[model samples]
Target: MTVFSVNHVTTYAYAEPVRLGEHRMMLRPRDSNDQRLLEASLAIDPPPKTLRWIHDVFDNCVAVATFSGETRELRVENRITLEHTPFEGDEFLLDDSARFYPFAYDAEETPDLARSIERHSPDPSGELDRWVRHFLHPGRPTETGELLMTLNYAIKEGFYYERRVEKGTQSALETLARRRGSCRDFATLMMEAARALGFAARFVSGYLYVPDCDGENRHLGGGSTHAWLQIYLPGSGWVEFDPTNGIVGNRDLIRVAVAREARQAIPLYGSYFADNATASTMDVEVRVRQSPSCELPSAPHRNL
Candidate 1:
């Protein structure tokens, strides 16, 4: 049976009350089998100064926001419908014998560690060859899937996902030095390493439900948000990688939207008339719910 209900609310009364907005995403008939019915609505008081387009890496729900004058308020709401499936430890098709998206050994990659990253590293992206290499190295996992798996585990093991106040988000190097970071840092390292290897990769942002076992003290915990990575492959398409839990997707995860980077999937973002890009403050809220009749079969399988 679907358990408790969760509602998230965040308010940022800017120094001065500015115009704002409340955009919404109307859940459509999703193409996934695990999802039954999904619906969501967003409202703004006094309406917004302006409503702009906002998207996330997962491209799940298009968040809406409105601006007033000086104190722009940002409100976000997330509603998800899920059909629980028993934890059966589904089958995993891990491929690693060969490269999916191959490219000629080119100098354009990482002139120093193309091979280190491509073969022994993450994806083909040069952005984090050195950083990712510190975690995943030659022949760690024989399969490409295993390579990613190694990285995921490495991140969870090496970093502490505690909420803190830091200036200028850290880079791959900085993250490696600190051995800690948010989803942004984790995804960046993964993307940079993958791209260095020559495979196309991108950053993704969206919502991920923390396991009940962890309660509210989890990474991307309730009201906090979630982050993961996606690597482009040849025959298999894009694959999701979660370093937080060292696990990929089963039914526990929801695939929302995708984009080149997290900025593209901000849920809601827009430039107004002037250069006042201070972004005084921004807030987001999300909720995932499972219905009563939609019981999670004791046995979780595709039945395929």
Candidate 2:
């Protein structure tokens, strides 16, 4: 088990003072068998009149903040410490029934995964279908794990990784045609491709831990929030695939939220009201570093 500390800060500056609306924040990390939250704290500038926490439809923890006054600048900072157990790609063991491609999910599990398995984008030209089919051989059973790993690595090697400051992700088709996109775009493409192959997939938003070893950085899309996708396997459950970095499992990925669409898992979003004022600038910084030890304080913040 490795301990990690994450710090995320977002600042929005306006040309003039504006009344802020209720802001929804999805900055808290999920506690799972592989990940355990140890401590968490959140601080906002121009404090909100009220702040409350609730779980969304997907059971992701969200913070709702309502402001009563106006401010020219709004800043949100979140800090968290957790223990993460990495899962290597080769460690994934598929059930015998699901070891090969072209397999169907259990009838009992189909209902809940139906929505995820349904393709969301319209591929009138069948470009994505053709692209995803290249990984399989005609009239031959393909190893499911190998197929997925190859596809994941293909994205990283085939597409150009560009950093975009945009707010939303581009369509899978767009990314394919351009042959270049941000991490989220790659994730969307992978998710849609998996869905087309009759697999349940979801978008994951989180932070990436880029370790500095021997004065060298080891990962991409670090120093900011990252995006990836998860495919549901029978015995393996939801297996993570980060096409952006060609990572097959969780590794240094720290998940904050999961959703069918990227927009639903935005880390922070809100609106401001002002007749003449407009958002002048928006800045975000994320840091994920390994802690020296796994020690904890006497009392931990369980609600975070």
Candidate 3:
């Protein structure tokens, strides 16, 4: 088990004071059997009139804040400390029924996993389908785990990692054509491709702990909110795959939220009232590091 500290700060600047609408934030880590939430806090500038926290459909902690006044700049900062138990894929035992390629989920589990198995978009172009089939040769039998691991490494090796400053994610087809994308695009591509091959997968939005392997091997999508995906194997359950870093299982991935699609797992979702011509810009900075070395600031009270 390893402990880590994560700080994420987002600031929005407007030309003039703007009335902030309700802001729903997914910044807290999701505690599970392998994870323990030690302490978490959120601090916002120009305190909102009312603030409440609730769990969303995916059971992620969502902080909803409403402001009664306008401000020129809005800042939302979050600090968390948690212990993440390392997960070794080798330790998981797959049921005999699902040990081979092209395996099927038991009838009892199919109904509940149907939504994840269905692709978010139809692969009319068949571009993604062809890409995924490359792993399984026409006449050769493939190991289920091997096929999935190969697919994970294939994306990391085949595509270029580009930092996109734009809002929203690119389509899987777009990423394939360009052979370049941010972490989210890569995750979406892998997720959709897995679904096309009859695997149940979902989008994951979280933090990545990147320790320097070497200066030349610096990881991408570390100092900001990162995106990845998880595939549910019949016996192993939901296993994480980070094509961005060619990482299998949880390893250095700190999951904050998971959803059926990328859009649903967005870290920050909100709006502000301003003139049609009003121009604004948003800046986000996230830092994740091993614990005890960095000191964290005091967090604001949960109540406004």
lDDT of 1 by residue, 1-304 (tens): 2332334444444544444434444222233444333443345444565655543334354545555554444444444444433225554443342342233333453363332234322334443556555544465433455566677778878787655433234566566667778776776666665665555665555455554442443435345545566665433445567676554543344545555554544433443332443445555455654344333333233211
| Model 2 spans with C-alpha error above 4 angstroms | 88-90, 293-304
- Greater lDDT among 1 and 3 belongs to 3
Q: For residues 242-299, write the lDDT of model 2, one tens digit per residue.
A: 9998887777889999999899999999988998847568999998888783332222
What TM-score does model 1 achieve against the real structure? 0.65
lDDT value, residue 140 of candidate 3: 72
Local error of candidate 1 at residue 53 (angstroms): 7.1
Writing each residue's lDDT as its tens digit, candidate 3 over 1-304 gives 7788889999999998788999999999878987788999999987989999999988988999999878888899999999987763335567877767788988999998999999897679798899889888578767777788888889999999988878899888888889999999999999999998899999999998877534443467877899999999976889888998887777778999999988998888788897655778989998888765533222121100
Q: Against the hidden reference, what TM-scores do the models get? A: 0.65, 0.94, 0.93
Candidate 3 or 2, higher lDDT: 2
Global Cα RMSD, each model: 7.1, 5.6, 6.6
Best by lDDT: 2
